[model samples]
Target chain A: MKVRHSRILRTAGDMLLPLLLLFSLFLLLRGHDLPGGGFIAGLVASAALALYIFSRDMRSARQVLGTDPRSLLGVGLIIAILSGVPGLLAGDAFLTSEWYTVPLPGGREFTLGTPIIFDIGVYLVVIGAVMTIVLSLAEAEERPWKR
Target chain B: MSLAVILPILIPLSAGALSLALWRSHLAQRLLGVFGTGALLLAALWLLQRVWLDGIQVMYMGNWPAPFGIVLVADLLGAIMVLLAAITAFAVALYSLATLGAEHERFGYYPLLHMLLAGVCGAFLTGDIFNLYVWFEVMLVASFALLILGGERAQMEGAIKYVTLNLISSALFLSAIGLLYGLTGTLNMADLALKLQDTGEAEGLVTTIGLMFMIAFGIKAAAFPLFFWLPASYHTPPVAVSALFAGLLTKVGVYALFRVFTLIFTQDTAFTHELLLWLAAFTMLSGVLGAAAQFEFRRILSFHIVSQIGYMLLGLALYTPLALVGGVFYLMHHIIVKANLFLISGLVYRLRGSFQLKELGGLYRERPGLALLFLIPALSLAGLPPLSGFFAKFILVRAGLEAERYGVVAVALLVSLLTLYSMVKIWNEVFWKAAPEQGAAAVAPTNNALLYAPAIVLAALTVAIGIGAEPVYRLAEQAAAQLLDPQAYIAAVLGEAS
Candidate 1:
């Protein structure tokens, strides 16, 4: 009975984390127009992940993330830079945003492009870097004689 | 040929990544350390020649052309900063060889150090604002790792405050970039300069963004009210890491403020300049007072770093070519001298286990050579005559007077005297007084040649710059002129920004 209860709790947390992350990403993508942003959304996603780690364990969380957080941060930054590069390639200056459209299978589709990609990059950067820092600090604190 | 411009940044970055991948191998790490710094130093010298001959070397990455591509430009100022960074990184790498133990040596120190060097060099050389933010994060992340490498209690505590404060500053910097991008639709600094020049009626928005950038850089530079994180955190790391950070990181922030203000935001000078002047004065006084209050040797040096930053800001606030030149010259001198002093602190710790002034004394008798080495930079830091510090301050004060800012001149002079007093206090406490009875025996009488080598090299460089001030001063003057003119910089980066 106890094992079942623990498994249920774990499964619920697992479901909840991705939901929170997706919600945060939604907020970030819509940020420049509204009240959300890369920074705040990143913080929210990282916080949710932190909660997941607290409920589960760091090693398990690392497995889910599939890489070192620092590497993730580096990649996020590179992506952010690359997102800005399209603007430059289009003969605008650095960080000058360009918009475009794409078609979906169902019908004619319109979607915002470069700026959202940039925002996603920012979201990943802040989320990955902040989580790396917070998790490192937490683990350091958890050492046996840290007190 | 102008690709000499990008090589300084590229060499260190590629080397840093390679070091990280090969971190487990001692040979690979050391080879990266040597080759990375050596290549950077050579590139700096080569670029200096290019700047001397061709005026300024500009490289647009990926062959995308100006304003559109990420540009790296090497003016005299950028070249000098690159050189200084290379010199200091070289010295610190040497010191680390002796100071960092097996655990630390094995734990990615060289990679982080090289990465930091790359970040600093990138910050110095980049011609765009967003790139500056990226480099700031690069340096900050590397510094965070270096800070907490040993995981001591103090180090962890300091890291927490340092990271939190820096994270907030990076956020502010990013928001400022976002706002600037939203307003002007550009992040190329050269392009922004032209756009901002034509942005006459939007002066309010320009001022707002200017102030935001100032505050952001101010927090990073630790200029006055934002300086609390410095003293709270600087002394926590091992001496070699602290030395590198004290020498390089905050100066990168100061360099950014100098660059942006001189280039893109000169339109809002009245607000930014006056605000800077008062902050400079307050930062000077308060930093010295903090130094006065410190009983630990490294803590005192840390506080003085804050104080010296105030001096640099004074040059910026004065806003004349000569004054800015003085700030640049002072920055160069301070990087070498400050790093040397911190290395000396490491030497002192090697001889005597503690860094508290009360526990250290009469090093004149035991290690007079080290005492002499320490004294030159210490005296230079106090702005004594016939030293690089004095020349730096002389130009600054002269510039202040030329601008008819007598109050600033008075404050700067008084700060110099107070700086001398603090230096003397450290000198007397650490080297002049009788050695403590227990310390006398506990302190080994052995010579640490490996540790002393870097300090000696830096001291020699300090004296060389002091005695050979003509060429260096002229270089600074030219750099200052280029900064004030902004035409060549903009032309190089944005094809005249029409």
Candidate 2:
């Protein structure tokens, strides 16, 4: 027999969502200069997504994802590969990073580079790969709902 | 500036990524498989030509300096191996297009094939030891998935054994790399060559690490006492996949052994090489005897693979200029013939509806064309005169005689005879015997030109390489010279070797 979880635990998992998501975003953006980056952020975000799925159903979880994990996998991989194109264009070796300085509204300089794009691509790939695994395992089981 | 060196990896990689993103479209994936492998073949050929002309083509990823960054280096041996691997991939890709059905396509067969190619290309091109390990893992992952794609019980069983054993090998490889890095403080092969030679201390530690590497690559190469995983699993997959594995997978291990022993771990030749010599003797004897006992079509071929690896290892064990050339030549020869044999076996299965030797019959009467095709590779595989294997075994035996290792040379010749006996057995049972009373299963796509195309093409290649040995011999000589003398390779990568 399947042991269903209590309503309170489901509610708590749902209520904890915003804070977990914001922390994951923070981890993603702060990764360039600090200890965090795309990989860790992806794991955290995937954890949050898994929690939501645990509290709800796979169909709703699919709706929340907005796209299949496989498409995300392809997109991430292409982005990572394409990010190297700029390096190739600059007559450098493949995957060589180039930096640019952008002016913010406060007259401060912000740095941008292909590494950021690469990191984001890595992030998406990790999430997509993990989600693909988790969802496949999850969806292999049969659950009942009204037709 | 050899950007061409990187294309072999990039072509398959991009194809896999593209195929992954377009998972819903079977047509797109199939086209990607075809175009990607075709482009890869062209790129590999270009890379081989570039290496032939320029000597050693080296490309540092992201322009990082050597000894610090990962470099893709294609010398004569590396370039030729990559070219042959691409050749096999192209043929097997064609075979898969016809063999892997709609269900397999839905399961991402095309992407996985490209992924395996990427790992193989990376393994060939990498100039770093640690990076070689990474490529091995990449191959392991893709191949494991491909091994059990249909989730058949036998496939799962075979895959379990393959994965478990390969994982242990990976752990040993990783630990050996870690120990070597700690000893020499470098991961680059050229730099390691210099550092390993120059170090006065840690002689015993170096030998121990060398043995560790041998064990790791030994398992991959399926050498004696560690070759069980190969015969246990190779026949379990589809024939196209098996052909791909037979053509390139074990050869990668043999290549690694040749590379590492020739370049990095030549510290104590007497002890290390003597050990390899005995291993080669046992490997050949057991492999051939195993083949003799097996009644299944692919299983016998699988056992023969182990036996053939022993020949390549014998060349390496001899450790002379002629012997190394023989090893390299044997690698090129065996890959083409073995893959063709496996592919032909698939056609036989399609016609006869079984892989059992007892059930398969009358192919010579039914389809003489297929019999003729089989005869070429089979004769060549058994070391007949004027074929590629004859030249390969001849050079190896001559090298052994020159080196005065008569015992192993005698064993090698004996194994060659046994190999012939097994080939005759297959011929008599599968092609010449009367059809069983139960009758054979009818085949699909009756014309099936696609099925015969690769086998015929590969059979022709075997004949061409046999008839025209001078140019291929020259390539093998150049490759062996580079392997025998590590200074040029080191200088090419690390700027004159200090």
Candidate 3:
């Protein structure tokens, strides 16, 4: 389970990690209107984290994340559930999406809606859940004596 | 009004999420577990009352038209099932507070339990077949985690069998859904019902898909030849989990079978129901026989779950109005009684430090209250008069006799005798016999109130169901009438325009 020290791989990982994270965010944002969505973005982000874990170690990966993946999962689910409440409050069915327009400084308008919020929640959950699984399995592998 | 349909699912889902967020705070998680389940019970009650008064209640998810988007529909049966699930969740939540160790609670027991409840409620309330499958997976994942929460050797073994078999069942279920969708071009169950009836040319292919569904749900319900997983795994979890599983899990499978057969697969009942009749007989015979051979408390009770499913299946297999009523009544009666018996078993374990019958005894002399509580569900399970099981069995037997299904009726009667034999075996060893000399060394826990309260309430409900059989019977009859004729459910879900 221990990873060997590889200078080239670590450098590659350092370069690729931020790029993958940025791309995942783009996928998540455009999910409502485009082909990409939260689920795929999550997988991509977790893959980036997995690369970091391999290059450095599980501890560094945990340190980079800075919080337990489980909390991310919890927050994600609550956000999704809350996203549905506005619809219910409006006397519509549960999960009914409502739209709003945001005007920026340049007078450009952006569409905001519950579906995108729901997709963000899905994005977080996918990342959190996949990372939780990958990290646990990797950690479990390190302690072969316990098994 | 629409909130009633979604609240049963949302309440548990929200509680689970909040519990996860508040995982470090045990007190908060515990309170959330209890109050959340309590809220679900109230919501389910409100839903049942609404359905009872207003006929089928439908909520189109996200305001989409039915047949195009998912819908949560609560007919009499769905509402009743949801209510029963909430009741079981509440009872188990209370019992879990006392029984679960701090280690397990910290490992997310409360959250997982609530998630399971949400899944069960969603399965019950959903009007779309694909949605039901999603709910089943949700329930399965939560249950898989709950089963192996402690990571004991035995639990791992049990969970492997449990998960492996269930995954296969899920695959079969998904494939059947895929095939059905391909044939009918619809996934909405009400719309599917309409389209399926119109597809006269594809009757044979439809029947094949129906059989696939039967086998899929049959495995879930632990019907005969597919129930080896139940006895192997159910007794391996902590008794609180066992009680929950015993109470609600298989019954959900039975509920799916009831819904599918009554609602969608009625075209070929001559073949499908006939198959169910034989499965019912064998499930009963084999289950009771398996219990008779077991000496462990929960294992015996576990086998009895499979056996009891037989009687419920008989109610469906008979396919008459009175027979369906009996099926519904048996469904309610079995859930209450089986769960009570499991809870009582947990109490006995606390007192004796073991679930092995040979190591247990003398409860009648030491704890008369526990003895009386035990006797209520035991005798009722044995179909003793003026108890819930008696009425459940009497109606099924009468329905069978009227239908002239003499062979299965004979088998049902025989299974009842054998069921009594197993209960007597537990009684003789665990209650009436002399306690082992070392048995007193295992000190009972101090929180006796929390331990006994749920069982006492459940036992009282068993007695109430027996005494108040008329109203419950009327509700079951109305549910049965609806199942026999799905036009109202179809209209409710797809609107009158359909």
Candidate 4:
């Protein structure tokens, strides 16, 4: 019953998830100083997962994505909240971003801040929240419930 | 110093995260929910004490100064409100432990509840209007998830109505904020106030935008013509969920209404406050009258919440110092009393195995002790003498008379009598009425003290606030005075680093 050309899209879907995941990580890491941030990265990751799920059945899809989205969401919240604690400890208000810089082998340098950590936390949460809804919708094959 | 305010919010949020991480473990959630809210309560009390000893406290976020950055401001009103929120959350958390069956717990209930608490605290403390919108959404999203968690048909139906209406309110709120920011060009409340004085000629435009806020917060507050969602959705949830929603959710709307109107939108009082007064009268009449026609247990209480909110709005609508104090006092008194009443309804459901009044009876012959617990809040809610509601109503009525707002005062008194009548109806049907001959099928009495403790604490609080009204009154008066003149708040927020 399936179309002959569908195999190409199915393979593409499988290939796309990893690439998308890698890009999501890139986005999350570079989010503080650039156009990419945790939320956008999470959305991209979720889009990749959604595509993968659409190309496969629910059980197999769940198997591929082994971790629970709800747990990811919780961990994300924990990280985000804890990221604020450093500011509190430094005797400023909660969530005041602190920073770090790493000297590269060349003359250039890399700098980071708590806001990035917070953004990563946001990234995890958005991915977790969106994927939870998507996977649950994917499971609802009959629209309300599935056998 | 900000730790006092920050911890009240952070403790719950972090606890939510930890518990959500351990979502599979019921034992972990139970321990975390109770202990976490306990920490929040203590922290809130400290925040209140600190604000009490000193004066208004403000903390800028990200080290940003007042005008440009978001700030958390804790005047007496915000401090007391945060304290109340923590207390209610703590009580409800304990109640949830005993009352939420495993299914509800497994459905991420604890995490959402904690998130809801964090949102409410954020709303109370935030000094920026736009930030308030974010907090409201945080609360809305958490509550929306909690509402539809079970995926029950009725829950979804109710949740859909709840979600749709709240979304509209939020959109209106956001647009109002957009227009406000466009108009004032500042997001912070103190800065907005400073800028709004120059909006002298734009009074009409200010009133228009202010009405947008009124309608938005009014929907959330469940005022007249906008409250249908509350009754439709509230009774459909499990009793524990309903209790939490009943206790905290709508009140947040009322709180926002009071906060924005008192702080930023005070330029055209005659028109805006006049509209509020009329809405307050209608909300009270309609809410109580709606309760009269409802035979279900939770539905009746649900309608009464609308009625009670009218009282709070009346306090704001009057806009006098004593009336404002009356409003603040009523806010404290009513939150404890209303929340306790809902918790008691959950207990009644446990005892009787049904929420329908027609199927229930005969508790008086057996559960006399439960009767006392019920009466404390019920009578207090009815404004019986020496209970918190009486003093709350008394101060409000006296203030109304002093202001010579005779018409609304008459409506308030008439509504009080009707409120008493409705409470008695619930009392007669559920507690005093004899069991029907064949349908005397009640569940075995639950000896679970955890189930009873939250209601007991709240009922005791109602009695305490009633018997010892002086200290509470003084606090409300102080809060009202500060609310009247935001000079101290402005100084604390905009004052040079001290």
Candidates sorted by TM-score, best first? 3, 2, 4, 1
Query: Model 3, A1-147: lDDT tens per residue?
Result: 445779999999999999999999998887877889888988888899999999888888888787788767777888889889889988989999988899988989988899988888888788778888988888778765233
Best by TM-score: 3
- Fnat (0 to 1) per candidate: 0.00, 0.67, 0.69, 0.80
Q: After superposition, how far is residue A134 of candidate 1 from its true place, in Å?
A: 11
Q: B1-498, model 1: which lDDT tens digit per residue?
A: 256776687678767756654545787788778778888889888888888778877766655666776788888888989989989988888888777876786556887888898899999989888998999898998899899888799988888989998999999999999999999998888888988997768889989989989999999999989888888888988888999999999999899989988999888688888899998999888898899888888889899999899999998988988889999999988999999989998888878778889889988898888889888999999898788998988998999999999998898898889888888998898899998877633444346676788899999999988999999898888889998888888877776433
Candidate 1 residue runs with Cα over 4 Å from true position: A1-147, B440-446, B496-498
Q: Candidate 2, after superposition: displacement of residue B30 in Å?
A: 0.6
What is the TM-score (0 to 1) of candidate 2?
A: 0.96
Worst 10 residues of 3 chain A by lDDT: A138-147
Model 3 segments beyond 4 Å from truth? A104-108, A144-147, B439-443, B496-498
Give the DockQ of candidate 3.
0.72
Between prediction 2 and prediction 4, which has the larger lDDT? 2
lDDT of 4 by residue, B69-158 (tens): 888888898889888988888899888887787888877888888889989988988889999999999999998988876677888889
lDDT of each: 0.84, 0.89, 0.91, 0.87
lDDT of 4 by residue, A1-147 (tens): 132436777899889989999999998887877889999999998888888776765556667667788888889989888888888889998889988898898998988789988998898899778878987666564355412
* DockQ comparisons of all candidates to the true complex: 0.07, 0.68, 0.72, 0.73
lDDT (0-100) at residue B78 of candidate 1?
89
Q: List TM-score (chain A only) for every prediction.
A: 0.79, 0.88, 0.91, 0.85
| Model 4 chain B: ten consecutive residues of lowest lDDT | B436-445
Tens digit of per-residue lDDT, candidate 2, span B1-498: 577888899899889989999989999999999899999999999999999888898877777888998888889899999999989999998888888888888778898999899999999999999999999888889999899877777788999899998999999999999999998889999999989886577888999999999999999999998999999999998898999999999999999999999999999989998888998899999899999999999999999999999999999999999999999999999999999999999988878779999988888998999999999999899899898999999999999999999999999999999999999999999999988889667555355777899999999999988999888899999999989989888989988223
